[model samples]
Target: MPYAVDFDTVSTAGLESSPVAPALAGLRANEARYFRNKYAHVFAVEPAGDAPEAVDWVHHILDAERGIVISSPALEATTFQVENIRMAYVFYRSGLSINVMYTVDDGGKRAVGFKLSDGMDVPDELASFKFARQRSKLAGTIRGSYFVIKNEY
Candidate 1:
């Protein structure tokens, strides 16, 4: 089942297995708020089991672009398109959230973003990247970093 993320009332409905469930829930809500505010799109996510395509897409990108592989299991995943941009998100049990933003137009911006929940340590595969902290009312302090996508997906 797809659960619509509510920024107004952050919940851990689909992320209970995570050690940093609260912070992860808040981080999920922050993404919901962004899409709602910017694109008038409701951000909904389903169990990773139910969204293999989205999960696989993210995995392929990680492997192809940076030779990176995440050790944590994904809890939920989502994929959607707004305007010309296609976006995918995977929420992992380690309190890590990864997003891929791909614009359909040639030479448009494309990147993979990594956001760590407030209470969790940065994953080993991502330690080399420096994360900048951002304060969010819903997610508390979020540490984030990203790399530009070099190849066409």
Candidate 2:
């Protein structure tokens, strides 16, 4: 079952297994808010078990583009298209959120983003990328980084 994240009142219903459930939930809500505000799209996510394709796609991109593999288990994931952009998101138990933004048009913008919850340490695989901090009302302090996608997916 997919859950539509509520930015107004963030909850940890499906993310209870994570040690940093609150921060993770907040991070998820922050994403929901972004889509809702920017594109009038509802950001809904399903359990990783129910969204294997989305998770796998994200993993494949991470591994192929950066030679990176996340050790943490993914809790939830979603994939959707808005305008010309195909977007995918995977939230992990370690309070990490990864997003892939691929524009459908040739020569358009494409990138993979990583966002860490307030209290979690940067995972070993992502240590080489420098993360910049941003403050969010719902997610607190979020550390984020990204790399441009080189190969077509």
Residue 13, candidate 1: C-alpha displacement in angstroms: 0.5
How well does each candidate superpose onto the true structure, as a TM-score? 0.99, 0.99
Residues 3-110 of candidate 1 have per-residue lDDT tens digits of 789899889998999999999999999999999999999999999999999999999999999999999999999999999999999999999999999999999999
Worst 10-residue lDDT window for candidate 1 reads 1-10
Error of 2 at 60 (Å): 0.4
* TM-score between model 2 and native: 0.99
Q: Residue 137, candidate 1: how far off, in angstroms?
A: 0.3
Which pairs of residues collide in model 1?
Answer: none
User: What is the lDDT, from 0 to 100, of the residue 112 in candidate 2?
Assistant: 98
Off by over 4 Å in 2: none
Worst 10 residues of 2 by lDDT: 1-10
Clashes of 2: 0
Cα displacement (angstroms), candidate 1, residue 111, comes to 0.1
